[model samples]
Target: MRIGLLTEGGYPYARGEARLWCDRLVRGLGQHEFRLYALSRDREQERAGWVDLPAQVTQVRTAPLWTAEVDGTWYGRRARRRFAQHYGDLAAGLCAGPAGAPGQGGYSPAEADRFRSALYGLAELAREEGGMVAALRSEEAVRALERVCRAPGAPRAAREARVTDLLLVGAHLEQALRPLSLDWYEEGELGSVDLCHAAAGGLAALPGLLARHFHGVPLVVTEYGVPLRAHYLGSADAPPAVRALLAAFHGRLAAEVYRSAAVLTPGNTHVRRWQERCGADRSKVRTVYPGMSAARFAGAGERPGGRAGAAGAGAEPGTLVWVGRIEPSKDLVTLLHAFAAVRQRVPGARLCVAGSAPDPEGAAYLLHCEELAGRLFPGDPPVEFVEMGGPAAPGLADVYARGAVIVLSSVVEGFPVSVVEAMFSGRATVSTDVGAVVEVVGGTGLVVPPRDPRALAEACVALLGDPERRDRLGAAARARAMELFTVEQNVAAFHRIYLEVAGRCPARRIAEADAAAPRPFAVPAELRVAGAGSVEVTR
Candidate 1:
């Protein structure tokens, strides 16, 4: 089967959130022919170029989400009217809010129908007129937004949105809708694929939605981290009006994607809950944990004195290791304070932060953590910051091997991949009780409350003081990882899901010429001729 793998700022791009998992999926399922439809988030990402693709990848189509290009093709008067009608409905739907409540001034069914029609109408216009960037940024777009916000049943927050808020929302919507104008939707492109697999939700799933609408292609959306959650987190500081509009837009899109998807695969239960709230059918949702490569950690269970243990001498007897991208959400400050408390009780304890900062902000945060460590600990049993450089960095398994306990202090988490990696390396863990951390850790690790340094410190100390308990927990952690989080398991789960979804979809009928007909079997004339030539042909 030919699969259309849709992604935004991932796979093919050297750096992005979901690149590694998507690459693994494509390579793991080599039986299917894949065509990548990627959306680049920035100029640097495009300049970085793509990762090496497998031979099974048939083609790749990409569009930039960061750059804006004008589409000058003029729409006839009739087309303009259609655009107004459809665009009006879309804007009105957004303005009325996503929850279909009468008291919330939500749109009625008739109004929602108008929004859907207007949205498709504008999409049709963009298809004919090349693109909608220029039009979407025009004053007409502002007026349209204003008209909807001031509509009879519009939400209070939306009605209060200023001109600037409308422009910002409009600009974002235009870029998100840019996929509609791309030529990838024709019969020769996405329409030809047997399945459409969206790597994440939001704009990445837009093409998949279009494919499902334009053709009868089945869509399977896989979200390791829910995009709507990220949108909500990121918009926390935005103006109320802007937040309201964007939230409504994202909520509606998520609902549509959930409603149309044949199957929804979330990496963990946390994301599954998010999908459920967005109207996904519980029967259609499956939780497939993200897979991790465990080959490097094969010797993790070996004793420190064994030949396979490289960190035999360097690893402190009671040290703790935290491996992840250094960021505020990781709650390094809490971890640092926790370590300080751990030091007073367990004087021999050390904390190794093994990972690089993902961004400038994270780098700064790392610096702050380093400063805090110096002030709090005053040089005894210090907090060691380890930078894992690309290729040259120490393997993650080795990092895990250097510690008796692994720690995760994240305040918010989706599917903590680092925690799974630690588990694969046979390290006992102490993690915050947030997101899917507890679910992934199960009974293998000690759980503590987030943002509470005392609880984190006590948990770490408990693991550090009990060597036998640590060993038992570590063994159980590794067993859990092998049973659930290995790449093979992930691949098998997806393979089954693909088959299940495809089975529900109507089967495609191939013409006689297009089908690979079996070759007719024939008996050799020599065989029929009895002892002709005494038989054997030598190579």
Candidate 2:
């Protein structure tokens, strides 16, 4: 079968979140033909270029979501009216609120219908005309936005939205709708695909939706981290009006996508719950965990600390490893505070934070952590901070193999790939209670309350004090990882799911043809048989 593999800022990019998993999927499912539809996040990502794709991947098409290039073709007189009506409804719906609420600024069924109609109408318009960038930035666009924001039943926040706010929201919407103008839905491209597998929602899934609309293809949506959720989380600092408008738009889009999809695949139960809350059909929702490559950890799991002593022979036995990107969300500050508590009891205990900062803020945070660690410890193990950059530390397996215990202090997470990797390495883990961490650990590690340094310290001490218990937990973790989280198992599950979806869906072109074909009304007299006094029908 031909598959349209859709992604945003991932897969084919050298540095991306889902690149490795997607590469593995394509390589493993060699029998299926794949056409990649990727949305590049930035110029840097485009410069990084694609990873070496396998022969199974038949074609690749990409567009940028990070920057908007103006396609300045104005709609004709009649098309302008259509744009006004549809774009007005879309802005109005966003200005009101999400569905199922009944009050001022809340959505109604009529409004929802209006939004859907308007959205697709605009998409159709974009397909006919060049693009909507110039139009979306027009005075008419701002006026429509103003009308919605100042509508009678508008949200208090939205009503306060300034011209600047309207412009920003309008600009974003313009870029997002650019996908509507893409010529990918032509017969030779996405139209020929048997299935459209969107890697995530928002702009990434736009092509998939178009494919389903233009062709009769089925769409499968997978969300490891819900884009709507990320938008909500990241927009905390934005002005209330901006946040409200963006949130409402994304919420409506998510609902529409979920409603239209043949199936919804979330990486964990946490994400599945979010999808369900967003109006995804329970029957269509499936939790498919992201698979980790376990080959690197095979020796580590099998030997179980044989290399631990070799690397840190003179160092303390109670060394804890925290490995991941050095971001504030990881709650490294809490981890450092927890380590101070751990040191109060076990003075020789060491904490090795092994990972590099991804951004300048993270780099500054790392420096702050170092300063805090020095102030807390005053001398001793010196808070070993290893930035795994060059040939010095080639990969994560070496990092995991050198430590007696692995720690996760994140206050928020989705599936916690680091925790799973630690499990694959057969390391005893101590993780805070957060998104899917407990579910991933599953009694194979110690769980603590998030953002609580005291509890985190206590858990670490408990794991560190008992070698036998650590070994037992590590063994259990490795067993669990092997049983549930291997790349082979994940791919096999998806393969089955793909077949199941295909079985349920009508064959696109063939079924359409069959539906349109005329049926024979009667059988030939020679082929007919007599039953009692009546003539029987025969094929």
RMSD values for the candidates in order, in angstroms, are 7.6, 7.4
lDDT of 2: 0.81
Clashing pairs in 1: 86-118, 89-115
Q: Candidate 1 on 1-539: residue-level lDDT in tens?
A: 67899999988899887898888988998877789999999999998889999988989999988886786756677766766667777887787644453312243546445555665677667777776667777777778889988888888888898988888888888887888878888766887777899999988998998888778789999999889989999999987878988887787788778878899999989889888877788988998999878887876745555322222224569788999988899999999999889989998788899988868999899999888888887746478888997787887778888888889999988888888888877778899999899899999999999999999999988888887788788878888888999998998888778766655566554223344752111111111122867664211
| Backbone clashes under 3 angstroms, per model | 2, 0
Per-candidate TM vs. native? 0.90, 0.90
Reference-based TM-score, model 1? 0.90
lDDT for each residue of candidate 2 in 1-539, tens digit (9 for 90 to 100)? 67899998999899776888888888988777889988888899999888999998879998888877677687788988888888898999887655574321235667767777888888788878877777787788888989989989899999999989998888778777778877788767888777899888777888888888777688999888889989999989988888889899888788778878899888888888888877778889888888789988766777554432122222248898999888899999999999989988888788889998878999999999888888887856548899977577657887887778899999988888889988888888999999988788998999999999999999999888888788888888888888888889878877766776666665554222434653221111112334776664332
**Model 1 regions lying over 4 Å from their true place:** 97-115, 302-315, 390-392, 510-539
TM-score of 2: 0.90
Clashing pairs in 2: none
